[model samples]
Target: MRTNKQVYRSGPAATKFAQAVKVGDALYVSGQVGMDESGHIPADLAAQMQLAYVNLEQVLAQFDASMAHIVDEVFFVTDMQDFMSDAAAIYAARQAVYGAEPAVCHSLLGVSALALPALKIEIKCVACVAHESESHRAKASR
Candidate 1:
């Protein structure tokens, strides 16, 4: 049986779209941008990238998942020149959350623009729901 799940983040910055939809063990997170709970985008690329990941992390938390559970990521950027540094920032952010898991699959795309004028990066992720063992839930709670 398929279970339809919905996560609503109570914030003006969050999207009305379901942050993730789960079918059995698989979870699909929506595209996340570099905006905070108040819908303000950061001024610089590095800050924006950090914000984007933060938003993703919040959504993942709702599913009892972390960046460690993420199997795939799609990174959209406004410019290729910003790629390397921006990628490094993302890596750093991931490391902070996931602690060097080799489970990441990624695709980077250079796009003309994103939805918001101040947004320079958008990230989408796919994660698998961890089995809800007592220990797993404990870890997720941490």
Candidate 2:
């Protein structure tokens, strides 16, 4: 079997990892952190979580995909205690981006540390998209 591989870079100063990769119909997004184009990493858990999703959005858009195209996601949080206490608002902000689309499969994990100590959360997702005209978002809504 043959597979096509593609890579995405957030910046010229980016790390040695592709933000997102497209192989056939699956788009594998790397763990997006709270940082943005301006090197901003929010200290607040909710803000960090929101920014992480935003980062995910930027990477996904490169492949003509959006959060709506996401089928599954795994979130790595540095502090489970803090996240569990403020889960509601964080989830709400995340939903604001995904909108009213059907729920995407999700998992929350507690980790000792992330790429940065200031980084509270990192999000990664797998999006199954169409090879042709229709996309994952268009197909899932039907």
Candidate 3:
């Protein structure tokens, strides 16, 4: 028996958690908070959301994956009321990176609190390796 499970670390969170993982052709990214390169959460929800999504995209790229490969995404926001105000901006940020990629299963959750009060948003994702099926089939044929 064998398994394919690899852990990856990136950015300021290298010590916090393996930012991403690959298990049997599936990529699971841990929740990413909205923090800047200097590890500070911005004061605005829109800013925070943009940073969080950017962090997710950059890390995914390191693994040869992109938002287009994403199958599931869970977004956590601090205030549903306030989130509404910046939703358009946040959406724009995501679009800037993802472009016209097919929509992935998504959930927007309003939470009373996040990892920190200053952190306005967090994003977690599960994606399929674009080559997963082909790799699995090739391995089986060998």
Per-residue lDDT of 31-138 in model 3, one digit per residue for the tens? Answer: 987897787888987777778878887767756777888899998887888888777777776777678644888899988898777987899999988564443334
The CA lDDT of each predicted structure is 0.74, 0.78, 0.78
Model 2: per-residue lDDT, tens digit, 2-120? 67566565564357777777777888998988887788887798888778877787777777777778999999998899999988877877778888644789999999999777988
Clashes (N, CA, C under 3 Å) per candidate: 0, 0, 0
Best-first order by lDDT: 2, 3, 1
TM-score of each: 0.77, 0.85, 0.80
Q: Which runs of model 1 end up more than 4 angstroms from their true locations? A: 1-16, 85-90, 132-142
Error of 2 at 107 (Å): 0.5
Q: For model 1, how does the per-residue alpha-carbon lDDT over 3-84 read when each residue is reduced to its tens digit?
A: 6554434355446656676655777888888888777888878778778888887877776778878898888889778667
The candidate with the higher TM-score, 1 or 3, is 3
Candidate 3's TM-score reads 0.80
What shift in Å separates residue 77 of candidate 1 from its native position after superposition? 0.5
